[model samples]
Every structure is written in structure tokens, then in C-alpha cells.
Target chain A: MTSELAAGVSGARMIELGRGECLALLAGVPLGRVGFTRQALPVIRPVNHLVDGDTVVIRTHPGSALARHTTVDEVVVYEADDLDARTRTGWSVMVTGRASLVTAPWEAARYRALLIPWTDRDVDEIVSIQADLVTGYRLLR
Target chain B: MTSELAAGVSGARMIELGRGECLALLAGVPLGRVGFTRQALPVIRPVNHLVDGDTVVIRTHPGSALARHTTVDEVVVYEADDLDARTRTGWSVMVTGRASLVTAPWEAARYRALLIPWTDRDVDEIVSIQADLVTGYRLLR
Candidate 1:
């Protein structure tokens, strides 16, 4: 628990999560929001993801707009947040990194086994982001 | 319903919703993701918002990181998506606009009445993004 003195010293009491906490939130969470660009306009979608080391993995249909827009070495932002409305307490974590399609058959197979899509649509395209920065924040009631 | 022949045409199979349908999804939705920046570093977060005309309304506590980063007249991106895992059918909408604080006393009061925060934290600052562009896509199972 954070003390009143510490809160006073900081002026505001927002909780800050470090690298380990941020990693835990990213790894344990199933749903996240991905932000990318199509024709220089921003697009965001919610997706289920899997975290492996410093990389985040997601799958999409081969002919989808996301597949068309995202390219190797393109910058993308991925975020996940958990909030408890009752307590008004929550945490949000974001990962910004370079995105690339995982084309290697063995790597794709490994991700395919671990990252299961609830949709029946065949997700032939797999994208992964090599995170350059990971940060998170928590709010305490 | 879209016909199979229509689906065969490139870009003809895309599902498009008008202003009302898009606004309904934006207002009724509980969770959304916002893509913004601080010094060109992309930051994305899950937020709860309301629809105000052609703009998206969001409230954040004063002195918060998000509040600090977002200023009036700054361009930002807001996105909302609703997905059904079972049917593999969903819609996503993106809004690129300029951000401005809602500061008029009467206007703020009206917004305060219409917009309620999902979190109990104090939200003294309210910002609205007047969308310059709005686009959405629907997935057909």
C-alpha cells in the first residue's frame, strides 16, 4: 500500500507499474487493442494475443484490411487495459514496436498452436511486433 | 444481405454502416482504445467514451498522463470496435480528429450530466475530438 506521505510527496497518487509489472499484464491478458495505419489514417481493432519473450503475436485473415496495411518494419502500437468499475481501479499497458508478418512455417506453426482464434475464419497471416518500449500505469482507489 | 456475386468483386463485399449505426456503436460501447502521441511516441489506451455530434468525448482526471499529453487543438486518433468471437463477425470504426477541451460552464454541466465515467476517479478535464475523418469496416462470416 502507498502511504499518505508518499502520495503527498508525489502531489498525485497515481500508481506506476514497472517493467516486470508491465510484462505480467501483457503476458497474462488475452485481449488487447492494436493500432495501425491504412493510407496514413489510423485504425484500431481489438484482438486476442499471445506474448512470447519481447514479442507479441496476433493472427488475421489473409484478405483482411489489416493484413493489407501492416508491413514488415512498420511501427504499430498495442495496448491492453483492465478496469474494475466497482472499485474505480484499473491498469493500462502499451507496447510500441516494429511489426512484421511471421512467414517462417515453423514459427507460424508455433504461434498458431499457442494463439488460438475464436473465429472460424482461417487466419493464414500471422503478425508479430518486436516491442521497443513497454510501459504501464495503475490507478488505486 | 450481400450477395455472393457482390462478394466476388474486389472491395464490393465490404460492409459499410451509415452515421447513425456508427454513432450507436460508439456511444453504447463500454470499452474503446485511443491512439495518441507524446513527442511522436505512439501511446494507445483503452477508454470509455461518449459520442458528441461528429466528435468523440472523453474525460480524464486532471494531471493524469493522458490529460497532460492531450491538449486542445492537437490531432489524435480514437477508435472503437465491437467483436463477436463466436460468429467471427464484428465492426471497427476509426476517427481522426483534433482534440479540444470542453470548458464552457453550461456545456460542461450538460456533458457532466450526459457522460458518466466508468471509473470513480475524479475526472475534471473533458476533451472532445471533432472527427475530420470517419471510417469503418465490418467482417462477414
Candidate 2:
């Protein structure tokens, strides 16, 4: 469990990724899934994201259950990966942190300008998650 | 909240998916993300899965945290999506259900042969999540 390397049955080895590399990979991806608790059960929503400094930011509408139910300092998980199914090789990064609504007008405005929502909806709420714990793995042959 | 039409800013309309359609889409995907609680916080993992009947099954090694920590009847969320970044059109399906380890020798063997593990690791544990509540959305431009 403590080892960083785990070889799979398909002749691929899993290498643990560093924080710096994880953040870099996250910034390059256009989409990610954010997981939060709803009714004490997990709920995942795939949304476009932008890496702002050390935080992961996403725009959601007021009508979205994700934005409406997320309380301040709520723990959430954001994951993004770039993998090839054919080769079974790629990297996946998961960031677990506290989620809070970006209520500041200027901050929200900046995020809105940089992070465009993939769905056709108004950007009514901007949620920023502090990347407190980052873990990732890369499968290599 | 109940009507099921939410359009994104990119002129894409979000249409809710039905149970039958969600299952069909899930069967077609080779990969998905499973979200479960770890230490009272959400954890998301990308794993290759197979839709067996109405359940999503994935194999894991014993050392993996997901398999080790997941308890019987643990509420989990499994999600799979196929989206085009350029066109901003795609479909996402989510299934929330209880996760149980496949302890039956025969059942485990069947899943082992059918569901290929993405990583190069031994298949020591098999997890099956019942598709209790299936929900999805299709983004159409």
C-alpha cells in the first residue's frame, strides 16, 4: 500500500505522480468530473474546469444541484485523466479539497472569463476548491 | 428541477436519459469513474468496467484502497461519459447504488474473464455495484 509502484496484469506499471506533475496535467485537460456528497451519497458531475493557481475552479448555474447544495468548506473530489483505452496507458489525477462558492464578484468574473461552461447555461455560480490533497498515477508499459 | 432540460452556454441542450438508454450507453463504454467515501470524504477512481445485467463490475487488487476500504452495501456512484470537446456535445450517465464484493468463486471467475483489468495487476477482488438509481444527460447542440 505504501509503495509507489504497482504493476498490472497487462504488463503495465503504475507510477505515482508528483504534485507538480499532477497540477500540470490538470491544467491541460478541458474537462473533469467533480464528486460531492448529495443526501449522504456520492454524486458526480462532469464539467469543464480551469486550473487557477493551486485551486480548481468550475462554473455552475444556480439551478444546478451541485452549486445549490454545496456548502462552504464542503469536501469534494475533482478528477481528470488523459488515457488511451487501446494501450491502457495514461495518467489520472485526483484532487480532494474543500469546496466553496466564489462569491466575490471580481473573482467570479475572472473565472467566468477564463472558464467557459461546456453546456449552454448561464454562469451564475463559480465554485473554487482548494487542492489540499493531490494524488495521481501514471500507467506505463 | 424536475423538467429535465438545461442548456449550456455553448448552445447545447441537456436532455435527461432514461434507464434503458443509460444501461445501453454504459455497456458501450470501456471505462468509468467510481466515487465512494473514504474517511468521510469523497474519493473518485477511474477504472475499466463491464455492465453485467444491471450491475457495473470492476476488478481490483487487494492492496488497492478502493477494494480494501469499501464495505458491503456501501453507497457508491459510478459514472461514464462520451463527450466531444470540440463540439461540446456528449452524453453522461451516472448510477448510484450499493457496492458489494463478489465472494462467490464461480461468479468472480466469470467476471474475471469478461472484465479485463486496465492496469497490469492481479485480480484479487471483484466489486459489483447494483444500478439502483440510474440517471444521465445528453448534450445536443
Candidate 3:
């Protein structure tokens, strides 16, 4: 149990978020960074995402580098945060899961409705993550 | 070599950034996300950073989970971006390398001068990534 005094003295308090709360926070943010490994070296890309049910979907070019990085069963991490530097307060949520393409025509169309390509790219591919673990933290001042 | 027409049609054009240019963009941003593997699962956390002559140094708590994940010569990725959803235009930069503590007392103090913790945490650990690859792209509408 972290005391309010200790938290106040540090000017930042760390609070853990439950699984459901983490999902809600993730759903609230539009932009997130996806992390995966390429050549055994970790790589991360910033992209916009949509939370549908328990899975997260994102649109990208079929020929883009992202597709090459997380196509089949690659494990990836998606993270979003709304932190304020001045107040030293905000929340961050991260979801870890396996990424796969949405190949079903009907499902693709449905997902496309929620996740739109922010940039003018073909964005023909929809990558959905079957989240395995979700966690979050809130920094309070 | 992307054509102007394609960019105009999609309103999101992708342009690659030069090495120096990418570093400049990185310096401009106050925070970025760090990606690494924990128990074979990829994880990420947003952090404030300082770009030294060539390496990136970040401050973290000694007991924080991140310290446990990155101290062992594990390869990591650091990323930052700025995109406007309305315009679908912005820049994204990523750096990949190994993370280790800044053991030298003087180096740690020097880095502390540049990178300050936004929240109240011990933040006594200085993790530095020796970037092996630096890449970036700009989306123009």
C-alpha cells in the first residue's frame, strides 16, 4: 500500500490498473506504438488503432513494412498513454498479443468501418491482435 | 520514390528521413516509448530521454519493472512520433539497440543534468541504448 504522503513527497504516485480498466484506457486513445522483434532486435512503430470487443485492429498498407513485421503469429505489444508533463499525471496502458491478418472479406469490411487509414495509403490489410495480457499504470502527482 | 500524384490522391504520402534529419526530429520530441522483451513477451513504456553525442539515455526507478527487463544486454527499440489525425501528416522515428546501465558515476551525473524524471520516483538508474539503427518516415498529405 503506497501512502499518500510518500506519493506526495515524490510528487508522483504510481497506481496499478485492473484488467478492465486497462482496456477502457486503451480504447480511449487513438494513437499507440506497436512493438515487435525483427532480426531479434526490438522494433516499434506509431500507428492509430481501434478497440473492438477485446481485440485491437489497425489498418496498414499490404506492402508496407508493418505487414512484414507482424503478419502471421508474431507477438506484439500495443501501448497508449495520456501523460501530462506539467502535472506529472496521466495513464498508460499496454496490451500484449499475437498479430494476424483479417483475411475474411466480411470481417475485413466490418473492421474497416472502425479502423480507418489515417494517412493516404492503400491500407489494404487489417491486423488484429488476440490480446494475451493487458496491464496499465497511472502516475499521479 | 513515391510519386506526388499518389500522395495527393491518398493525402498521406510517405517520405524517408535522412540520418541527421531523424536525429533532429528525435531531439525535438520530449518523450518516446521504449520497447524490449520480458520473458519472451514484448513490452513498452513511455519515457523522457536525452540524446547524448550519439546514445540515448533514460532515467528509471531501480526497482521498476523496466530495470529488470533491460539491464541484461537485451536489444531494445526507442520510438517517438508526431502525427495530426486531421491532416494525416506527421513524422515517426525509431532507434534500435542494446540497453545497459550508465555505470560511470560522472556519466550518470552528466546524463541526470539532461534527462529529468517527470514523476516522483527514485529514478536512480540510467539506462542507455547504443543505437544500431535509426530510421524515420514522414507522412505528408
Candidate 4:
């Protein structure tokens, strides 16, 4: 069964997403993947996140794989994409920045209020990735 | 609007996926994210891929970000997940391995016949990420 979502055309062009538009799209999505390294091997984890100003905030367990792999000042990537499963047309926004754990009380509280993990676990650590560089693209066809 | 897909329960236990199961799941999915590093920053790109034995073969443009970031023996992460949008219950599989440009004539031809890029672009590079270590998890609720 097809829904009202936009369908992919036979011959569509690629559209470059502006920085502002990329941020807007990223801020709107709830699920995103975090890219990082563990023991020098690249790793990706799907985490529920929220865009807080210029920072991408995600709730993770203090001992989660993400937390263990990410450290202060470590460069990480946060990407979110919205694609029509049927049409396979979508837009992807990627943010490259440094990741740091939220240690301050007020800031941690703020993140805690805004972001919630989709999985059940003790989520007290708030990892924030600075959205220093944003790049995006739209696939239409 | 509820579908018959698994709905996440409120207090479901986390299930660990074995290596064989993880590889099987990865082989079944047509799309996955490739994680790599560019200038020391972690990056993730979504691509259509197929599992050819222990190798994950994908097609991408020669000048694509993924192609530029990946080199011979470069460590990369390939991940795939199928989570319900409404229920948010799904399984995720991640493979950590080195990305290599397929140079063998026979392997390239084999990959070309089996894999196709989802985007409209000149896909001249056939990349194979060696599935060295596979890890997966299932969220049930």
C-alpha cells in the first residue's frame, strides 16, 4: 500500500542542501547514527538524538558503546536521513564535529530534558557533538 | 495506522545477536551505512550493498566522499538496521573491517553484476569492505 509521501520520479536530479536547511532537517529527525572509532576501527551506532542549537545532543548510557568509544575533543559524525522506504527517495544531513560529555549540572539537565533514548537503559550521560560543519544532499528520482 | 510489525514493549530485554545471525541479517538488507574517517573526522554514508560471502560489496562514484575517504586496508564500519518508525523496535548489525577498492577483474565484474547504486551517478568504483568483526543487537519491547 502506498501512502501520500512523495514518489521518486524516473529522472530526478540531485539537490545540494544548504547549511541552514541541513541543520533544520537534522533538528527535526529523532533517529541518527553516530560515527566514531573503537580501537582504531570505525564504528557506527544508531542513537536517538535532538538538535540543541549548534550542538547535536544524544542520550546514551555512561557505559554504552558510544560513550566508551567517544571521548573529549574526539571528532565524530552525526548523520540523519529521511527516505521513503517505497520510493527510496530521501535527504541526508551530516554533521562533523567534536564530541564531549556533558559534565556541567545545568547543561546536563537541559539535555536530559530535551533528549530521551528510545531504548530502555540507564541513560545519564549526555554526549554532545558540535555541529561545526554540516553537509547534506537530496536524492530525487 | 498501526501495522503488524513488531511493536516495542515497554520493558523488553535486550537480545544479543550471534555472529552468524548478524551476517545473515546484513546479507538480507540492501542498504547500509559505511563509516570511515576523512581528515580525522568520522563520517557515515548510506549505500546499497550486497553480501558476497564474507565481503560486503558496494558501488559508488569514483569521486564520492566514501570513495575518497576509503583506501586499501583502511578500517571502516558498515551498519544496517530495520526499526519500525512507529514502534521503534528493530535489530541493528555492525561490521568493522578494512575497505578496499576491488581491483581484481573477476571480483569487480562479479560485484558489478550483483550490486547497483541507488543514486544516479557514474558508479565506477567497486568497494569491498571485509567483514572482519560483526556485532549486532535486537531491541524487543
**Which number leads on lDDT?**
2
lDDT of 1 by residue, A49-107 (tens): 98888888998888676776565477788898776534546888888888888889999
lDDT of each: 0.71, 0.84, 0.79, 0.78
Q: What is the TM-score of candidate 3? A: 0.87
lDDT score at residue B114, model 3, on the 0-100 scale: 62
List where candidate 4 sits over 4 angstroms from the true fold. A1-12, A68-71, B1-12, B63-65, B68-71
As for lDDT, the candidate ahead, 1 or 2, is 2
Candidate 3 iRMS, in Å? 5.7
Across residues A1-141, which tens digit of lDDT does each residue of candidate 2 receive? 111123233546899999999999999999999999877889988988989889999878886667765665788999999888888899999999988889888887777777766666665688998899999999998
* Interface RMSD after interface superposition, model 1: 8.8
Q: What lDDT tens digits, residue by residue, belong to model 3 across residues A68-136?
A: 766658888999998875576899999999888888988987776666566665776888887688988
Cα displacement (Å) at residue B125, model 2: 0.7
lDDT of 4 by residue, B24-53 (tens): 998887788988887777889887788878
Worst ten in a row by lDDT for model 4 chain A: A1-10
**Best candidate per DockQ, number?**
2
Q: Judged by DockQ relative to the true structure, which candidate is superior, 1 or 4?
A: 4
True contacts kept of 3: 0.63
Worst 10 residues of 1 chain B by lDDT: B1-10
lDDT tens readout by residue for model 3, B1-141: 132233343447789998788888888888889988878888899998878756788988897666876667777889988887667789998988888888898888777766667666678789998767899999985
The per-residue C-alpha lDDT of model 1 at residue B45 equals: 71
- Winner on lDDT between 1 and 3 is 3
Candidate 2 — which residues are off by over 4 angstroms? A1-9, B1-9, B68-70
True-contact fraction in model 2 equals: 0.66
* Collision pairs in model 1: none
**Lowest summed lDDT window (length 10), candidate 2 chain A:** A1-10
Q: Is candidate 1 or candidate 4 better by lDDT?
A: 4
TM-score of chain B of 4: 0.86
